[model samples]
Target: MRHTKLGRTDIDVSQICLGTMTWGSQNTQDEAFAQMDYALDHGVNFFDTAELYPTTPLSAETYTLTESIIGNWIATGGKRDKIVLATKIAGSGRPYIREGQPITAKAVHQAVDASLARLKTDYIDLFQIHWPNRGHYHFRQAWNYDPTKQDRSTAVSDMAEKLEALGECVKAGKIRAIGLSNETTWGTQKFLSLAEERGLPRVATVQNEYNLLYRTHDLDMAELSYHEDVGLLAYSPLAGGILSGKYLDGRKPAGSRGTINGDIGGRLAPQQQAPTQAYVDLAHAHGIDPSALAIAFCLTRPFMAAAIIGATTMEQLKVNIGAADIVLSDEILKEIARIHRDYPMPI
Candidate 1:
């Protein structure tokens, strides 16, 4: 329920952002509605979704179903102005979206219009690029990541074009703020510099995966956010439910994220299970719920604007929302740092 300013903007969002990727895939519309209603009641005023949502299998058929569910909620008497809605435009390399075309000015215009239509909202509070067109390391691609092949000129030009399109959307009142997702420090800085030079929309936030098992944002991204006024909207604070310890001891626990997407997008490496077990044991030893511990850690980070959380059930939603009140002690934080050092980047 704690609120913080989103970047340099005057808008204040909850410390915990309700993530809606499971709306149409793992959860029904009623379940999604229940989660949203509960979150709003608990003072969560921020929600994050993407065009390519309900991503258990990420099929073309269910591509925009999540947005449609939100649209239905708005159509059925849900107050649109009560929450700060954030959505993403998927980047290149997805066959279902624009035939895997790289994001261009025309693509941005089309994507923003489509998202607005689907969300049944005149303007989005925050609009983000789901990923970079010329990608860097993200989604477990770090091991094989190579940045030497990137064309700097083309990347800058693409950012400029995208910003121009975003400016148009702002003028048209389609979106209020702009953000980036799955982006690196260099990319974020470039976008900010471009926006400043051109007087376009300023990049307000960066959504990246940050959890007990994955702390990629702790390095350069953290420093960039601290100095640049761009905040971190951390997704997967539970490491796709790995830090919750439900999948440990060879138990799938039916309907879990692991059961749906077997590997959890390469997060279940052989070396990761033992580390996850240790964290689970630590949580139990301290009489704390693992999910609460993981989420609390995210909230305590210096540069974190909000921790984006998703749950398939009302019970899970309740547990995650309760994390907003769990404060991690200095001793516990030291212990966590030790564990992180012992097993860094297991996935």
Candidate 2:
């Protein structure tokens, strides 16, 4: 697997990050352990998880269970030193976690300690804020997202406090690097500027949804990533498996994400159908697995640090990790671009 320096940090991570959001929910502990073992053995060293995981059907009962599973795996296999582990603390919106409170200095310290205990690790390679408290256009919120209602001064103040807290975590050896997820260009710029001015923890990466169907990151965020040296940890490179054509013609395979979660995060809308079919057809025409083609397309981007791939089955995991090695030829790339022009933002 190809590797890259995480943002401007000296830490190196695999270009393909193993995503573990289904553990302990859709998958059993043994299944998660086997997936982790196979991923690490196959050259995938980076793994991404969140405190609010097993999100296929998120619930209070399954809260933090995924982390516990990973902790168990690390403790049993003793492979903690061999992996670059990354996880996130959820922001406001979930009542079960911290009573739906916004991220704060005290919350940062508390979360770091709690995650450390649950992960059974001394330090997190990359600890990220799952989303902004002020909220941004992610997870199908772009259509009606209105930023004018936000209080800028308050938001900046909150960011300053969070940075100070994260800086303390760095000092305490709880976390090595900090990142952002589901954030906007303006928010990222604010974090970067604050880190420089106050000697706070620098924003090393931005984890956002980036796939052929979702190209919102290709505009201002892409430029920011290039100039600021903040790499993108692209999530949903397969568009919740839409790019795989499994959901075409309204067919839901058994145990698929769509079958479990009815709409797959509002991704089963009518607009995405033609574009999805086009990409899938293009992949087949070139004798490539549609899933691999979608993921490989992500790695080709100039600012992509890693493409986060998740799987419910071992077979799916193998296909996703194998995508790291499938280099798309120029002919295939141009064909992809042509398809993109035909349907830029279907999702």
User: Per-model C-alpha lDDT, please?
Assistant: 0.91, 0.93
Candidate 1 per-residue lDDT, tens place, 1-347, comes to 78998888887899999999998989999989888889999999999999999898688999999999998888785689899999999988789999999999999999999999999999999999999988879889999898888986798899899999999999999999999999999999999999889999899999999998999999999999999989999999998998898878777888888988888998877778888998888888888999989999999999999999999888889999999998888888999999999998898
Off by over 4 Å in 2: none
Off by over 4 Å in 1: none
Model 2: per-residue Cα lDDT over 18-79, one tens digit each: 99999988999999999999999999999999898989889999989999899999989999
Cα RMSD, each candidate? 0.9, 0.7
Worst lDDT window (10 residues) for model 1?
70-79
Distance (Å) between predicted and true CA of 218, model 1?
Answer: 0.9
Q: Candidate 2: lDDT of 186?
A: 96
Q: Please estimate how well model 1 matches the true structure, expressed as its whole-model Cα lDDT.
A: 0.91
After TM-score superposition, what is the CA distance of residue 229 in candidate 1 from its true location, in Å? 1.0
Cand. 2 TM to true fold: 0.99
lDDT of 2: 0.93
Give me the candidate number with maximum lDDT: 2
How far is 229's C-alpha from truth in model 2 (Å)? Answer: 0.5
